[model samples]
Target: MIRFQHISLMRGTKTLLENADATLNPGEKIGLIGANGAGKSSLFGMLRGELHADQGEIDFPSRWRLAYVAQETPALDRAAIEYAIDGDVHLRHLQQQLAEAESAPATAANGSLIAELHGALADADAYTVRSRAEQLLTGLGFTLDQMQLPVASFSGGWRMRLNLAQALMCPSDLLLLDEPTNHLDLDAIIWLEDWLKRYAGTLIIISHDRDFLDGVVNVILQIDEQKLKRYSGNYSAFERQRAAQLTLAQSMLEKQTRQRAHLQSFIDRFKAKATKARQAQSRIKALAKMEELAPLRAAAEFSFEFRDPVSAPNPLMVLDDVDAGYRIEDSKGTIGKKIVSGINFSLQSGQRIGLLGVNGAGKSTFIKTIAGDLPPLSGKLHTGKGLVIGYFAQHQVEMLWHDESPLWHLVKIAPDTREQELRNFLGSFNFPGNMVTSPIAPFSGGEKARLALALIVWQRPNLLLLDEPTNHLDLETREALTMALAQFEGTLVLVSHDRHLLRATTDQFMIVADGKLQPFDGDLDDYRDWLFKTKLVAKSLNAEPSPPAVSERRNAPADTPVADNSNRREQKRFEAQDRQRISALKKPVETRIKRLEEQLAKRNARKDELDAQLAAPEIYDAANKETLKTLLTEQAYCAKEIEQLEHEWLEQQEALEKIS
Candidate 1:
């Protein structure tokens, strides 16, 4: 358990937290969230002991181990799995100590030291650490071939994944994850959510992804007005609770206003009639009744609205047999391989389509082709006359002048537009007062994203091509964007890992896979089902299945086969083969499961023995104080080890069941 009593903290000259009181219980998974610059990472620093509170005290056991993802990775020549295993500081230290002891002569002193080190390593679960590290790497989307490669061989994004795997590899009482999904694709994100769900330690994660937060966290710690506030439940629950409170308060004032209108109408109706005096008396009483209801002074939600396009294009673009992807050019100027082929996509006015597929499946390539940022490799691409596109991608945020303010960036987009109008628009996106002039270079990723959207809305585009627009946006900003996109009177094509955003904005979905771009005639639920089956098949066969052919791509479910006896017979034959292969595979898994069950039983029995011994009043005697402490410590350690083993056991069970 951890407690903060009337804590206040600062970063440089800015107050990050002031007079905030909160307590975090054991095994609580908390989502630390706020708008950009609200000091989420600062609070993490305080917990890790790098940042001290200006006032008040933070109370926690000094021996509590904390695990956090490293922001930077060295260009090491070490194997990736070896680097991940190195995160287990205790295990690594014990190994090094044991190695030194074993190098010395086999004296009594050396022997005892070696034995103690070996015991510590066993307690830390050092055995099979390499296999565990490899599992983490695989979950994060690294292939087995990449596990033994040098860490220096991977790119920055892959390095981030390595860092996350390393952080998860470490044993800790508390785990801190900061935007762990930023570098992950949808599949990897799903895998990570499962991993986090199984983590028994207290988890504090900072992320802008609402869906991810809802899946992993049970509580929210929000930073606002220089204070940290705790809210019960997941992100959606918090939103609902907050909304209900706001509604009730506003409804009181609305009720009074409606009563006032009713009274006035009665008075007006009876003013010239025989009941004039009675009506006036009733009106006065009703007006007095209004005093009981408090005034509703709640601040309005900060949101932005996209303006209607000046001209609506019936068909925004037409891709006829398009081959979308980057073309390789050399001295000979010859075009090379295409990523997506036979893409017969048509974007009509008011169409909202969400792009879906695994990472590197050419979703971005198709989007770039439609946006005219990239030309098709070998097909006719036609655009309607006077087509205006508001293309929003992560790279667009980077394209802005680093030294410019939000106001300055807007001015560059619309030079003739009034400055006040631009300021008003930026204010709607939460860039108000000094923020309008502050250099965006110093802004957080979320703030920059908001500004980028603000710039896009200024042009009143007829079509919006957005690729992960909600990547760094907070819940409020994401909601605002969702509302805006839902109401936008234009064609929209979005590529996002944020499912909440996709559900809110997109009316249809398109899957980019196996070199084809086609409609996905199913909702998110069905897509998930297909995804699970696809992964299971790939795992069983040790290879990826190809996508449907171009001719069979549209107007039906992707998994559907023609209703014929021949196809049915072929499907049944393949299914039979899969079942036979799976049954053979399950033998080893079942054997391992049985062994783990036996080990768990033994551990539980020992724990019960300790529990009974600790329950005895004689164990608490003054002479047995050290004995009591040892038993308690060992009990806690045993519980954690068992919990981890149970989690591993479940994963294996799931794999076996997926095949079945």
Candidate 2:
């Protein structure tokens, strides 16, 4: 439905996409894969038409519906779940129209017309919307009461979920999500994966969540070395295919290198011979025509070197049955709102704990309380004797001065620390030379994040509290951080969405949920399995889940002179049971397939509407333009989804026919 023809996107001196070409078709779930700074997000921005390519063209059908969830979301006052979800002006307008149509008195002249309109509105699912809105909100990890709370009341991470809900709820054909799984916990991530898998609209996602990629996406589109490569199947399958291709490339390169070396050696030995000179010249020309071979080497290595612990166990932070929650200022603290309470947790030496929960589950609040940013509403928190701690907040990017250099900031914070020591420390975190003196203001979000990390490590605190530390980091940086923390030999507590990082860097898992923290015994894999198997909404929404029902066996005949005809009766009974089982299983598949078809139909209609909006001249209005852009993206996504579902429905139908 959308195609990029020799597209090249350059921002000043750097090329983000170099003559990249690809086609996105209906029913294909594409995963945008690359290392950090590989231009995945930039490419998505181009697709959203938020940024223009320096060269070439992006060709796609006009009037496509598109919805995008950006990396950062606007913070809003906590509002009711129902209010926020249905708050979109357009959706609300539809709701009002539907309501008016239903409330209008019907006379004999217009009774049938009004009745027909009412049915259409119902099918639109535009009115009586609170329940549906609540359902989606709850699916995304909000409690019924939590949904009604002002969005401004939520922390940045929770606010992200609200933003995600807006994107998901928006009527669109194509959905573009950038690192959508960041800041979310195992449960929320699993829930999102299922939601996308079952989603009937087209989806293009840039995520580091391996499990999500494996479950939700059917194809992998990799942008490596500024080139686009496509692979069929999910992440694991793509990895295998990529590995094979790389292996073949390596083998060919090696063989060519050996042949070239042998030829050069022969030429070198007889270069002075008059007769051999002509042959040598011919060999050189032949070699020049061959493509330069890439070296065969293992993927990049993640290594770390850190200062050893200087002291023994130093209890950093102490929580004494501390009930903690942020209280909003309500004129002299007379009236307040509590975010989390009854939180009792502590950090001790040599302890590595992974915090777990769904999005907006108070994981960040728990970390912040420990970090000493916001005081506890009730209960006591004590610091250990001579405790030195290092903290990395989820929004650490906000701490950097946009106008000041990293060196200036570091020197200002620690005047006593020598300049040489600071530079060396920063270098350890991969910031070297001009990078240390570069102004933080122009640094990308990821670079700023790394700067923050570098500054924190310089402190060399025995206690470390990290909240979503891996969120903005690329795979390579994340690996480095993981290694650094694993060898720290100090008390480390982390709240992160990267399962591989969590599993590799921490040993224990603690969940801050339902107003408390509980220890989970199993590992990341175990948590993932439990999430998929136990969460009902996640299960129902999973794209690759088994068919809705399993075939059941039928009842066997009971009477017929058992001794005389036992064998025949037994055979008949088995056959009957088998037939009944098949019938039972077929029923649910048909029902599910029908539901999928209905959703696909609605999405197609939405796509058509979005296409028209994109093609309209009225889109020049700023607000109308933004809305149109969103529509275009959603339309592309919807077209892709419709195709995927249709393929799945066809497969299911075939299975049903075979059994029948």
Candidate 3:
């Protein structure tokens, strides 16, 4: 067990943990959660012995081995597998000793040392370290050929995965991982979740991904009000318990407020009266003796809605046998090689789609093609009229001007908008006061991501194309984004490894694989099963073949006729034609439904505006009798028009559904 007793921690003058206490039992998988700058990482530092508590002490087993992912990876001309194997310090030491013994001149002592080292290496299972390291690498989305490549050749994100693999490769009593899934894709995340579930050692993870936490951690430790609070069960359970506590606290506070108010009123009314002065004095003393209840403070609270688009055209874009890929040009300037080919898809207004696949499966390529960052290599790409797209990718965050402030960025995009209005918008994204005007170069990755999203939302786009939008955002910001996306009336197509976000914001999923794109007719769990089955099939194909037994041969079915293949092909072609015909038939109805929805939105917006006008006290004055009458008449008209439009919209929707 690990224990912290009266632990007080401070960085500079800011108190991060004040007299905090907690106990972590052996083999417990703990999740450390808090807002950014809330000292979750600082606590990890203390546990690793790199930092000390300002007061009191932490106690744990003295002999326990600890392993944590390195924050930085140096550019080394060494095989990736070798770097991962180096994580096992004990094995490395044994190998070094064995090498030294083998190098020495022949002698009885040297021979004996060599034999002993060999035995120790065998005991440590050092011979299989390469295979184990490769397994780790594979689970983290590394290819077989890439395992032997130099560490210096990989990109930043790939290098982070290497560091994580190194950490997992280490033999330890306790393992610490901070944001392990940030660089991973959905498949890799699922793989890591399974790996962690099978791990026997104690684990502590600091992550903002709710579903990931829920899947892996058995306990949740939250940093609230400068104290370490422990909760049994996973992240979801913690949320429920915390919500209940907050509700109870709020009720008590309200009760206290009412009691204090009543006592104060009594004293104010009778403090000078001869008969009741004594009772009033007693009440005053009672009121003075009451303890003040502080107002409940949420960790972080801010939300901003996407502006309505100026126009919403049905079928926002269409791809006809398009090839989404990068140009493979040299000095002579050749056209692009196809990463994904024969892509025939349509993006309709009000559609919410999630894209899923393994890493390097052309998900980003498709998104870039749709965002107009890349041109289709071979076919026509039709964009709808008045189409306004808000495209967000990781590189968009990198494109922000480091020297400029959030205010500057907003002003650059909205030059006609007032400064106060821009500032208010930035505040809604948690950039308050000086933070809005200060250079964003000093901001964290989460802050930069929020700024990028804020800029996109201000554009009033009809179609939103987001690729891994939740990468650097913390839990609070992610929740806010999920809420905003849920409420967005425009079209949304998101590619994210965050399952909670995808599940919350998307209604359907499309998969990119084998140089093709297709609809995924299942939820996230089914995707996981599919990934597992795919791996099994790949493994079986790679394995050596074995001869069939006599009984198995007897049970095998006879071969079909050669003509059957042609017949099956014809059947598939006919099915494809039927699907196209149905889609063509549905288009008109879908268009009608979209137009009706747009009209309803406009009318509802106008009705809201009129309702706000009618809420004013001046609208009821006698001097404005004629104005009031006109307002009333218009309000009634709006109500009736809204009713009729809603009915028509519902009918159109039903008609469209029937066609589908």
List the candidate numbers ranked by TM-score, top first: 3, 1, 2
- Clashes (N, CA, C under 3 Å) per candidate: 0, 47, 0
- Model 1 lDDT per residue over 1-660, tens place: 889888898888988889988888999999998867788888889899888889988898788889999999999999998999989988888888988877887665555565566567667777567768877887788888999999999999899999998899999989999999888877688878878999999999998888999999999988877777788999989888868977997988788788888888887777677758776877777777667666765665668789889998779888899888886778989775799999887788889999988877888888888888888888899888879999997467777787989999989889999989888888878898999998889888778888889889989999999998877777778888999999998989998878888999998988888888877877776676566656654554466644433332232333667589897776676666656755765765677678778889988998899889988999866666547656766776677667777876886688678646
Mark the regions of model 2 whose C-alpha exceeds 4 Å error after superposition. Answer: 35-37, 49-65, 70-116, 146-160, 183-186, 236-251, 294-305, 314-320, 326-348, 358-362, 368-386, 525-660
Indicate which candidate wins on TM-score: 3
lDDT of model 2 at residue 438?
87
Q: Rank the candidates by lDDT, best first.
A: 3, 1, 2
lDDT of 3 at 490: 96
412-446 per-residue lDDT for model 3 (tens digits): 98999999999988998889999999999989999
lDDT (C-alpha, whole model) for all candidates: 0.82, 0.72, 0.85
| lDDT tens readout by residue for model 2, 57-78 | 8886667677876455555564
Clash pairs for candidate 1: none
Candidate 1 yields a Cα-based lDDT of 0.82
| TM value for model 2 | 0.70
TM-score of each: 0.76, 0.70, 0.80
Q: Any idea what lDDT model 2 has? A: 0.72
